[model samples]
Target: MLQGKPLLGVTLVITATLLFAINDATNKYLLVSYDVPLVAAIRNIVHAILMIAILGPYQGHRLVQSTRPGLVIIRSVCLTVGTLFAGLALQLMPIAETTAIIYLSPIIVVLLARPILGESIGIVGWLAALGGFAGVVLIARPGGGLDPLGVIFALCNVGATVSYYLLTRILAKSERTLTLLFYSALIGAILFGLAMPWFWFGAMPSNFEIILFLSLGVTAGLGHFCFTAANRYAPASVLAPMTYSHLLWAGILGWLVFGQLPDSWGLAGMLVIAAAGVAVALRTRFARR
Candidate 1:
């Protein structure tokens, strides 16, 4: 039922997943030594600079062109807010747990699309979303030693991400990919820059920290680029399951980097959430048939 260069798309998705996993782990490590807002601000600024430098000449003035400026700006805001929240959550929570919770964004987008995009969700979709939420609850259970504030931040990230995805759908038909990508980074940089003064710490980062800070932008840029490129090669349905590989990468990196592993409940929760997200994607795929 799925079409396009499945092999290439699958490979790109897997690559993107791995990069994103590494990005998350790196973010968590840096957040441990720096304030979350400062980390987010610097990351966004670097990302914005890299994107503009690489894409500006190719896109020329059309880089910023958008048929739907309002929606584009709103989408950018969502991305920025989501990044900040996720950074905060990573500071207080384990990488694997934070990642699993953030994975709930795709499921939330499925539900949110019903009202916001006038898309319909079948009974299976509803059940899958509930199952995903139940998984999140397990991971965030009381006395689990997880920070309550971190969990809240994770949920907030999910909310903003859902909005971002929804707006992406609305803008995809009218806006160029570079245009959308440009705005996402530009707005994030501007917003983060505005808040930098308050979050800036006087402590100087080590050279290694500086390298990781720079790689944050590199990974984020390349990850999204690969994911977007994959879509051009295959249907989203075919690539959707590949995204689950992120959990595996996250788990491995979390263990290697922080010596932290998700416990039984947390592991089970991650699995359930991953399964539910795949289910939701499959449901949408089959429905289109």
Candidate 2:
């Protein structure tokens, strides 16, 4: 709650969002350059390493300490499902589109917060939720004729993301942040590993591919760490919508790396989502102050 920490949290969240967007954009590039199943597998393997080797030094005890074991377990599993599902969505869909759909996570979080977290949101949160949902609809709508499979994956990611944050909210009180990160990574590795056999066609990544895949894990892990801290230091109302900054970052990365940019529709939808989220963030700040 110190001035520096909250400011750090906000900056961390923004930077994390940028890294996360870059992660997706890079993953998309690698997905094109390499095999999906293999890229997915390597990403997990490297990520699992980061969880154990990298995070252990900072906060190792978080993994074993527990106040809500069942909640932690459920949250881990849900995130595993969500992460793998989102990866599959990426394999089927364009990166930019999938990223937009994933923005729906905050809307789901607001909706679920009432029942799960017993948080009372005012009209502003609801309006933001509605606007965010509309953005998803705009992207997924049939007239756009986005690939049906892509839409399915994107929507699945929405659920996966919601489950992730919901569990994060549940764990926020009890679990050490490291423990939460480890669980998500551990579950994602195992769950996705199991599915690997079904989809695995081993096209071993080139040296460059290996680095790219590892960066995926690093970006995600660090990004999530910052993301968690953001919620910890500030209210969700302050931080939740800021997560949507990923879109702006993603659009830039997509163009710079892949020469892909969201069209007019994508820009319009993102603007609506941004406006709605910013409004919610502003309202929350005002109410809290």
Q: Write the per-residue lDDT of candidate 1 for residues 1-289, one digit (tens) a residue.
A: 2346889999999999999999999899888888876777787788889888898778788988887899999999999999999999998999899999999999988888888889998897899899999999989999788999999999999989988988899998899887888788889889888888887766889999999999988898899899889988889887898899999999999999899999999899999999999999899889889
Candidate 2: minimum summed lDDT over ten consecutive residues — where? 1-10
TM-score, candidate 1, is 0.96
The reply for model 1, stretches above 4 Å from the true place, is: 1-3
**In model 2, which residue pairs have backbone atoms overlapping below 3 Å?**
none
Model 2 vs truth, CA RMSD: 2.5
Pick by lDDT: which candidate is best? 1
lDDT of 2 by residue, 1-289 (tens): 4434567667878988998887887778776655555556666666778778876776667655778878877887776666666666776666677788877777667777888899878888898899987887777677775778877877787787788788776777777777767776776677667766776555666897667877988888788777876766666656756677888887787788777776678667777777776776687677777
Candidate 1: give the clashing pairs.
none
